[model samples]
Target: MAKKKRFLKMKIATLIMIAVMLVITGCSQSSGTSVKDGSNESKSSSGTLKIGFILSQTGTFAPLSEGIINGFKLYLEKHDGMLGGKKVEIKVEDDEANPQVALRKYRQLIHSEKVDILVGPISSSVVYALRDEVEKDKIVLIDANAAGDDLSWSKKSDYVYRISFSNWQNGSSAAKYLANNVGKTAVVLAPDYPAGKEVLRAFKDAFEAAGGKVVKELYPKLNTNDFAPYLQQASAENPDLIYAFFTGSDGIRFVTQYKEFGLKGQIPLAGTLEFGDELITQPAGEAAEGIITGINYSPYLDNELNKQFVQAYEEKYGKLPNIFSVQGYDSAAIIDKAVTEAGSANSEDLIKVLKGISFDSPRGPITIDPATNNPIQNFYIAKNKLKDGGIVPEVIETVENVTMPETSPFE
Candidate 1:
């Protein structure tokens, strides 16, 4: 009986040693990687402030998201990666341009990663999907590149703030320009999404108010590859001008196909910022030339800060910064300002600090509107021109203080 007891004790000690070895190996692996959707990319630093960045790393929105990340990092680089004298730690996630994936990434950023501030996944739909959750959790979400109108009005949360253009600003500004400068008869087309529909409505209201007629309004299904049929319908109307809002790959395909349909300059073309996005303009080549649009920023804007920003961006990213990057840069600037003013990571304090703050952005002087919590800044009516070097947005007119009214969303 004694001999049997000794053998059993030896076997028990051996099993205990193996279990501890497995645990130690597991710890090493966990420490080496991050807690994401099995992603290996990570950017961590020692700090009191943790900023979680959620944007696309794959799929259609990748280019725009890449620019946004670059811009955000550029600002931090200049500021020594320290915001408001607090060591800033950044956690980035790849949303893959999927709303469901975005939610999962967001939860990790909030609960698992424990980020103090959260900034974007550049899609209006994605932002809306995560909106209610953020409000319920009482987290700070600075709208970087998502320009949905609801973010300003109906579905707004007090904890939410926007540093980018609202759909109304883009549509109304372009509509006013088209009526006064372009033509009296117009046909507009856009992808059938919330942003697209809002653009259509805002444009219609402003154009009609200015004594212009919208002969036809077409909403193609989102992610449409073929714009030939839509272009034909607009041409059949025999309109004096054409306006559109196609984003991502759709934008690229529309501009390229519009020229192929031989309607390039015959009717004259104008749109919101998407029509002149660098991702579309450069890829669409001559098709993008002479396209008139309205936007908050253009790389060619004449300002000391803008010039410096463009130069540094080109050097670092090997490409011209577009509206996405400019908005991303501004988002970082806003966060810095709020954190510095509040001197704490408290959500209530940060929201108060952001409500009425003003700053001189690369685009121009901007302030957070207390009523709508959107940027009250200039919107530019620009024309795309292909120079010997490259195609760029040329500022023709500047509309100052373009913002949403306190009570808006008229039918």
Candidate 2:
């Protein structure tokens, strides 16, 4: 498996270079058009388009980031690595899931590396820290996984484009699902951070509006390992269910502990998508089973593009594609479409094209809202189920063309 993964990575990089060269050759022979257009003055003058990826490659969020990287590579592999007749080059920098470090790396990539396009940091805090720099640089920043609701409207910048669901969609979709399918009374818990706060707020507001009752709300500090106190508080309140959002190490620890506390199956757990992530579920073991959550993508989704993606992903990496990987794949798809439709990799042109871009993604059809630079895609409710001796996410419900508000107060 290790050898195969290495080979696939090498193949993705090499094939892209080879394909781009072929396109460059074709362009030179047929069209007198030069790859170096004045639109890319601030960008590298070389015909090759450079993409800078800023995500956690170490620490707790690394696995999620790895999915994004793999998905991006797979998309490049399928397309032979050429985007709009340009040889695309990728430069990656690990932020270690730290905002300060992410900012430093973002500056380095923009200045020294001279990457024309910027991808992501999975942590919302990291994204917030780098927002100013991203705006100053004016490079297209593709949000691969961070679901900070503020990004949609409040902190919305023309330079940013997101393929993933927003925090509002993430939280509210789960609330809608739980209220209709499960019990209407629940407790909401989230880490006290931008993304968490936004997600919790969205859930609380929607659940109440949906004729549900929020028994309690808890905000633990970011990276809290022991959810015992929080769990105890929930048990005391004794709501019909528990709706919470957690990711990274916190998620794994929370579910395991929740089960240990003997509340797993009894209370009926439900929350935002991250808790249902494969990375979190497998580690949490049987603790995660029957946990209902909502997401925009799931390997269980049935569609031609999804089937092709799942098959290609499994063959290449020996695993199923998750929300993180699908987000990365969609990011690449967006880049490919924008670069093609804009007729150049210039930031201005790319932004214009991306606003109206619509394509069939692994999650189904998606379109970017020009006003907010966020996606309009299907929202899915997934239940963690034990399948083939392992925990897998199965899509049970799908909400199509879900979008964010024009103005997000959280920004």
For every candidate, C-alpha RMSD to the true structure in Å: 5.9, 12.2
Question: 104-163, model 2: which lDDT tens digit per residue?
Answer: 898788767767788997988888888777777677899898788777777888888887
TM-score of 2: 0.87
Model 1 earns a TM-score of: 0.87
Please, what is the whole-model Cα lDDT of each candidate in the order they appear?
0.84, 0.83
Collision pairs in model 1: none
| Clash pairs detected, candidate 2 | 16-81
| Candidate 2, run of 10 with poorest lDDT | 31-40
Query: What C-alpha lDDT does candidate 1 achieve relative to the native structure?
Result: 0.84
Q: Clashes in candidate 1: how many?
A: 0
